[model samples]
Target chain A: MLNIGGLNQGVVIDHIKAGGAMKIYEYLNLEKQDCSVAIIKNAKSSKMGKKDIIKIEGPITVDLDMLGVLDPDLTLDIIEDGKITAKRNPRLPAQVTGIIRCKNPRCITSTEQELPHRFRLTNKEKGLYRCIYCEQAYKR
Target chain B: MKHVISPLDLSMEELDKVLSLAESILQDPEKYSECCHGKKLATLFYEPSTRTRLSFEAAMLNLGGSVLGFSSADSSSAAKGESVADTIRVVSSYADICAMRHPKEGAPYVASIHSGIPVINAGDGGHNHPTQTLTDLFTIKTLKGRLDHLTIGFCGDLKFGRTVHSLINAMVRYPGSRFILISPDELRIPTYLREEVLEAGNIPYQESKVLEDVMPKLDILYMTRVQKERFFNEEDYIRLKDSFILDAAKMQCAGKDMLVLHPLPRVNEIATEVDDDPRAVYFRQAQLGVYVRMALIMTLLGISAG
Candidate 1:
């Protein structure tokens, strides 16, 4: 077992698909964070066989739902007083704004810089998202 | 009170209201002629579509409203590098309502977000054309006497036909509306539509390469042009260009009451000889575009017939 220190108070993002921790790290903009963040890539797990995990030491605000979009099977654990306080599994959000950009070149967001790229989850089972403005489906 | 960005934006009840108002306008044109008196319609067409622009202008004029704005992007401030949001912010102040046709897919959506007045999407790339859908629905109801329980056949260029996609989305909301999709394999309907729309709605549909085979089963045969501009390869366009031509012989297989429709400026997909057929209703469909726009303008402006 690889030993890593437990966080005094922070969040631990677990069960990220192996090798996906770097993307989640970049997506969360952790590089610029003033606090400490440890990224573990391809850690052994009995359930997943191999997985990536991100641990942040200190209170921080992160959109878990976005992490769900990046990796639906991810689990989040909140640490308080060096003990696991809450365990949460992020589910697919019904609506997402400014997270995923509309890829359609003709989408108004491509030209109009002020509009936020918004999408609505039209099908949960298929993981389908449609642009709010153009209704163009996001290719999975 | 809302801008029409897609056919799905309007609920079935709201669609019925628009169609009912259109029917009333058809029966008593004079009663609604001056309903929009002293109002203004700004037509901000970023692309050249003579028929769509003219229909909107004529519709507003018939309702006693004045028309303003340019015919193409080169003539408008868009050519001066003004963004759609900024242009619409300025235009909405001058006009009571706005109708925009842009080559970019969601340009009208951006305009609607920034404008104060109701924005109507005349057409937008291969993405959406809500007014055309309204025109089609109005024509369907007018000719078939109902919008439900009809076997609608869509032929040619289903892959890029925004009108066909919008119409199918609208029709599936009604019960007993089956679709007969006829097109070359290269031009079949997109997979998202097949899955999200037909399959999700559990709407019964059949795909076929032969148009004549499905003609007899159709209550309405909607033909679309095989748009050359939509093709990436010229050879592919040339290969499938004549895949489904509705000639007089093909029409012989259709029912006497079957209505034939096309979103026009066609390129040989529909034979000229079919125009003389009693079942041909594309011309009447084009004319209905004007009345439907009138109804839409009135409804959007909250104007009621006298």
Candidate 2:
């Protein structure tokens, strides 16, 4: 049995798709954070079959919008005084700014270095996002 | 603070107002000659397009407004790596209104974000060219006498013709408007347009390769150039080039009142002989283009004629 230590006061991001923990970690800039982060990859689950999990031992504010684009299935739990405080299900933002880069070479955002890469959620069902300026569909 | 980044920027009612102003300008150019006496229009062209640039300058000149700004990126600070935001912020102080054309898609949109004055997108790469669409809408409403209830045929390169997509977008807003798209198999309208714009709007349409077959049914035959660069093979271009050409013979297949419209700089898609036809309104469309632009400038600047 693989055992992990419990968090005292922090966040437990659970139900992440298997192999997605590292991405969440990098996106959150966990390496720069002064908090302890534990990544559990490919953990067995009856619901998702295998999922990745991240436990942080300090206050952290994940960009819920970015998290939504990364993994909608993932659940977030906040702990305070060693007890679960709040649970969060990050939802996809209507307008996404400066997260995923628009890939169209003809897009103005491509040539302008300082322009924020902004996208609007066109289809929530398909998880479709389109560049606000160029109208180029954001492809995963 | 309004910016016309795309054709969809103007509502149908707003389109009517602009077109009405265009017709009035054409009726009596004197009434609106000095409407914008104190205003200035900045023509910011990031690419070389003498036609569009001259049209904008002419429009400003007609409105009694002085014009300024560079015609090419090399002449502008853009070549020196100045951002669109910074340029627009600076240009806003220099001019009351600005018409911009850029090779990059959505460049004007970026400018719109930073602009203190109204920003008109002249042409943005292969993206939005709202003014051209406005000009087209004006031509149709003036010549055809109505904005709706007509069968419009889009012939030639429907695939790469952003105008066709834009027109379809504009027309679908009107009632009882249907389309017949005539293009070669290799140059069909984009699938997203077919499904999203057409099907989503419940717009009735037909696709055909034979222009002759669709000509008689059309009230408006909108033609576009089929650039050789759009085709992958030389043989295909050679085979398809002559097929899409609008000649006197093809005009016989069309109705006497079937107005033909083409965004100009024609390269043999339209035979020179068809220029004599009263129905061939492309030159008139060009004239209307300037008038429409004058109206657009007036609308943007809020310069109503006294």
**Across residues A1-140, which tens digit of lDDT does each residue of candidate 2 receive?**
67888889988999999988988898899999989999999999999999999999997866654786767678989899999988988778888887778999999988888888898988787677889989988865
Q: Give the TM-score of candidate 1.
A: 0.92
What TM-score goes with each of the models?
A: 0.92, 0.88
Q: Write the per-residue lDDT of candidate 1 for residues B1-306, one digit (tens) a residue.
A: 689888888888888999999999998888888989999999999989999999999999999989998999999988888999899888878999999999888888888888999999989888889999999999999988999899999999899888999999999999999999998887889998998789988999999989888899999999998767877789978876766888999999999999999988877888999999989999999999999999999989988887
Best by DockQ: 2
Per-residue lDDT tens digits of candidate 1, residues A3-114?
7899999899999889899988988888887779998989999999999999999867776677776676889998999999999987789988887778898777777777
**CA-based DockQ, model 1:** 0.69
lDDT for A89 (candidate 2): 80
- lDDT value, residue B305 of candidate 1: 87
Error of 1 at B28 (Å): 3.1
Error of 1 at B277 (Å): 0.9
* Residue pair clashes in candidate 2: none
DockQ of each candidate relative to the true complex? 0.69, 0.77
Docking class of 2: medium
